[model samples]
Target: MKPFVKWAGGKTRLLKEIEQRLPADFDEWENVAYVGPFVGGGAVLCHMLEHHNNITRVIINDINDVLIEAYRFIQDDPGPIISGLKEMESIYNALSNEEQKQMYYTSRKTFNDMDGIDCQKIILFLFLNQTCFNGLYRENTKGEFNVPHGKYKNHRILNESNLWEIHDALQTVDILQGNFETVGRRLLREHVFFYLDPPYRPIVEKGNMFTMYDRTGFNDSHQERLKEMCDYIDRRGWHFMLSNSDSRSSDGQSYFDNLYNGYIINRIEVTRFINTYNATQRRPKEVLITNYQPPQQ
Candidate 1:
């Protein structure tokens, strides 16, 4: 099972490196407590649920309301979402080329204008994703979905098989919508592990112009706050693994290296599948900071 919803900073390509660096006992330990503070597309969560049989409890939280509820509805009920997508697909395909372009913008406006969360809003959310450029989800300062329509030969808006698989994978998962700081509030001390994939700290100064998973931007302060949490996690004797950009700040020094200097910070060459400028250009360095150093591979 894989994540159906594609979001920015997803770790689909780095899953292997991430798995190897995990605590050695992760796969064997039973009755474990797992927490995902910034579950974007749940790439790690999906891997753990399918591969790690010992996890007893899982708590997945994200500040994005639409993303969190999408998980909830997918796990609890996906029939309505799928049916709505089918209707949308039919309506979109029946239009002429020009009509389709108009329809795409119209749908985007309706998606942004939606009020009061319902299955329909969720449906539009998925629809916009399918038709949006590069499947990218971006929003403006007004908390509106503003990504332009994408031109694709053929798109699959509804994937019943994958949705069902994702639904099954999330049956025992606890989904929450809130800040990342509150994630570890009620979590137990021992036998708990946290995998944090927060918004990437921009490499270039003021380079985070379009990093809008949420309108509430994650800036340097949030990065510092996350560092403090890592310190706390170590002091509390809990295990944690974090992924962030390895871009050097304007000072020509690795910012993440300084932030996570005390911990086991390992830099790995990563491939970016979705390139901002060009998809073909995708070689970059990403830092994986862990509290515990697993056995060498």
Candidate 2:
């Protein structure tokens, strides 16, 4: 099952690399729990639940309330969400290209001003993601949906079957919203698997530095906090993996090498940017850090 909406920094392209590098004990354990602290796009979460029979419980948490709300609406009941999508599709398809663009900005404006990702409003969130420029989620400093309208051909707005599949797969998933620390409370004695994909730190100083995905900022201090969480999780004997930028900082220093010392770090060449459509900003490499060794064939 695919994600309900297209997300920035989504792991859709890297799922295969991630699956091959999962902890060795995953197959050995009869009933394992899979957890993702920053489930942007949820490509990995869907993959794990769909492909692995050993996974009994899946806990997917993210800081974005709108994204989480989309997940919950899909999981609990996609009818309203689906209905909303159909309405948007009908209205969008009936209009001229110029009118569609006009409606797009108006819809975006309505979405950004709202405080919560309410049931009615969440569908517009999905619509904007589908029709916005390059399908990327970019908000301004004031938290407005600022991306221009995307002129894509024959976009599938309301995919009913896929949504149903996602809903069924989410039956085992517990969607939590808050800081990454929220998942710490759900830890247990069972053999647990952690896939932590926090927002990637900028490789170069002049980079856009996606300090804030929503309203709050995730800076170097947040990265440090993530490292600390990894340490605590590692000490607790939970198997874990993380993804981040592999580039050197502006000072020509390796950022993740020292942060994830004593851990296995593999560089994967990625053709797409972690969170953007800017061709100039697309870095070639990404760091995949793991605490446990994968069983080799």
Candidate 3:
């Protein structure tokens, strides 16, 4: 199953190593409840479903309402959504750059004014996501979508087949829109595994910062709150696995080391394509944290 959204902090690159780190008997454990407090791309969730059929129930939650609404739409009328997105993409391709900008801002304004999930709002969301720079779902202070138009003319706005596959995969899971802490409070204690991929702390002074979908950025306070929630889960005996930047630049301190001190942490070298212009900056290390100890070799 494909991810429901093109999230900024998705873990698509680290999926393989993360899978290998799991115990061989991980899937055989009965009554498994897979929980993702920050279900960005849903790549890990989809991987679990495809590989480990032992997951009895899955729960995913995100604070972004637009993302949640997209999932709901996928669950209901994926066909119409795909069709609408295709129409929008076609119209977008025919426009000049100035016209495209006009359409993007217009759709964003209409989306902000929309009260509910009417057809128009859904189309607007799809249109903006496809046209916006990097498929980013950014909003302004007043909660209006504000990302500018991207340069891509042949964007794959509607992936119908992938949407259908995701719809099928999500049929057995519960997807909700809420803060992670609120969802974590009601979780049961036994046979549960969590995968957390929060927005990574900035390596550079200004590059890695991301405005929240609703315009509220996840700052130091939010990170502290997440740490508190993770600690609570650790106390409850639930397994925890997390990934974050492993910056080794001279001027910066490692975020994972500073925040997750005294926890089981592993540093891995992962190559990521940092920019379309220069691929040299792509090779960077990332840190993975797990509550469970890996089996000895």
Candidate 4:
């Protein structure tokens, strides 16, 4: 569903490479299922709906609360929510610099302290995402959205047509928030296609690997656990694909090497874009690891 929110580690850029690795008779498979354990921006989910209508059901899970909330809102009340967001956008656009600053802080304060599904919570979440630095979702120890206002003042908070399309796509899917391991256990069906896009191990030099937004960073140990999980799934004969950083870090040899050494793997180069305050540090490279063997033409 176009990812209900903008996630820091989203893989919207790698959709084409990911699509290329799908099974040839993917549509013929009965009871086809798409499971994303760590569904971020849901770029893959949206892409699947647009391209692969054969998928009977989709299961999306995440550990982030705000993200789940946004997704649930879209699934249940997309029309009203989109309208509200558009109204909010208009209001936000009309505000002066000081007013915008005031709105950000006020919304942040209310969201941090409150613990209910009210208009305020949803509005605050939308406001923060629209105004936050690069639409980055960062939270403190107390689970407060703390990113500063971004430079873009005319952000599109809501797209009605897209929301309508996403809502239709979501009708055939189930959404949840929890650990990936749990998702693995609950999924009993065979021939399911799983796309695992966990947080990538950072390649930046001044790597504050553990950031406020991502408190539970995907470390070497977690990567090992993921390897084990994928192995277990492989034994069960379920088709799956995984994506991660191709380069190595202080942790170990490229994430692809450590995780999918014995499994069928393919390398695809993707153009990574980074338009932040420091624009000079952006570049692109190949991201590795996969299990699906696409048919040769």
Candidate 5:
């Protein structure tokens, strides 16, 4: 089970590190409610659902409302999306590279204009992600989809079998849009295991890191607020393991180390696959913080 979209911070490469750090007795925990506060590409969510049968209930939340809606459309019915994507793929792949670039820009305008059928909006969302530069979902101050064309000669706009598989997997889960805090607040009484992959704090200078998932980018204050949420989860006796960028700030201060002072911080060397103009930043680092030590440890 793979993510339907290519997200910037998707955890596909770090899945091994995350799997190793899960609660030692996770398999034994029956009737578990699995919660993902920031389900970007849903790599971990799909992993949990495929490997663990103990998760009786599943809930995921994301700040991007349109992304959440696309998930919903997939969960409910993927026939329309599949058909639309097939047509788009046929048209795009037959075109020359120059024509494909022009088509990409036109689609971007239509997506940003946002005055089309609801179903078309979702279709364009997937189209842009598959063909956009580096699979980025960035927005301008006006909340526009502004990523440039990828100019690829070949495209995989439609993955029919994968879409059907994803649709089947999503049937058992509840998808939510809005703040991450709301997921725990409503399910406080349930025994939940949260795997958080919030927008990481930038490890490099401005205009380098891909932090703009939505119109309102996550800043330092938002990182502090997320730490408070993690504290709330810990206090409630809920299990959680979070992933974030591990690079230090300009002053050589460990920001996450200071924020999650009491938690167990595991620094893991990682190589990201996302396309970047600067090749030097390809091999970045990440940290995994868990409230309780994993059984493997």
Candidate 6:
């Protein structure tokens, strides 16, 4: 049950670190809801559903309405999306290299112009992710999808079985499209475990932020607001784990350490798999901050 789309700041590579830090009592907990505030790519979401049976309820929310809508489309019925992707794949695979490039831009325009929920929007979202540059999602200030074609060869644009698996996995889950605070307010009374993966702050000052995830970019102020939410969640005795870029790369700064004071923050090494804009901007470290100490393994 892998994520249906390629997402920047995906947790696939960090899953091992995340799993190792789960509360030791997690498996013993009953009827706990698993909440994902920034459910991009949904790698961790799928992983939790696959491995943790204690997570009887799941709530996933994102700021991107289109992405959430895609999730709903798949959860409700993946048949049309599957059909659209198969047709798209058949046509895309037969085109020449030049033809593919032209088709990519044209399809991208159509995707950008599209509004509201429909099967085609979901189809184009998945298609652009597979064919887009670096399998990355970027947007202009206007929120249009702006990644160029990746010129990939023999890419499997449609993974039919995986879609079915995702559909089945998401059957009982609750999906929401809103800001993180909205999610926080709604979960105030739930017995839940939270995994918060916000957009990575720039590794260096004003240099390489990947916060274009939505038209409304996440900035220092938003980070502060999230920290406030974490404080509220922590005071309520809820368990949460958060991931973000280690800001001490070149400037020797401890921004997150100062923000999440008194918490257990582990600086873990990570390979830069996808270079979004520049090669030099790919930092090799990230931090996992947890409110409660993970039990010894």
Arrange candidates by lDDT, highest first: which order? 6, 5, 1, 2, 3, 4
> What is the per-residue lDDT of model 3 for residues 163-281, given as tens digits with 9 covering 90 to 100?
89988888888888987886656766577888887766555544555536566667667777888877887888888888776643345766667777777788776665433112245
The number of the candidate with the highest lDDT is 6
Candidate 6 lDDT (Cα, 0 to 1): 0.86
* Preferred candidate (lDDT higher): 3 or 6: 6
lDDT of 5 by residue, 29-101 (tens): 8789999989988999889989999898999989887899999999999999999999999999999998999
Rank all candidate structures by their TM-score, best first, as comma-separated numbers.
6, 5, 1, 2, 4, 3
The residue ranges of model 3 lying beyond 4 angstroms of the native Cα positions read 96-98, 204-208, 247-253, 271-280, 295-297
Residue range 178-287, candidate 2, lDDT tens digits: 98975955566668889999877777655655545676757888888998888888888888899987756678877899878898888886667434422364646789
**Model 3 Cα shift for residue 202 (angstroms):** 1.9
Query: lDDT of each model, Cα atoms only?
Result: 0.82, 0.81, 0.74, 0.71, 0.85, 0.86
* Candidate 6 weakest lDDT stretch, 10 residues: 275-284
- Once fitted onto the true fold, the runs of candidate 4 whose alpha carbons sit more than 4 angstroms away are 204-206, 210-214, 249-252, 273-281, 295-297
Q: Residue 109 deviation, candidate 1, in Å? A: 0.6
Candidate 3 backbone clash number: 0
Whose TM-score is higher: candidate 1's or candidate 6's?
6
lDDT of each residue in 208-231, candidate 4, tens digit only: 443344445456677678888788
lDDT per residue as tens, model 1, 1-297: 778787777888889999999898777665788899999988999888887778888999998899899999999989989889999888887777777779889888888898867898898898888888777777678999888878754567788888999988888888999888878657764688899998887666556433578788678898899888888878888889999877577888888888788788888877765564222447767789999986697
Kindly provide the TM-score of model 1 when superposed on the true structure, using C-alpha atoms.
Answer: 0.94
TM-score of candidate 3 against the unseen true structure? 0.87
Candidate 6 local Cα displacement, residue 243, angstroms: 0.3
Off by over 4 Å in 6: 188-190, 249-251, 276-283
lDDT of 4: 0.71
Q: Give me candidate 5's TM-score against the actual structure.
A: 0.95
C-alpha TM-score for every candidate? 0.94, 0.93, 0.87, 0.87, 0.95, 0.95
Q: Give the TM-score comparing model 2 with the true structure, all chains together.
A: 0.93
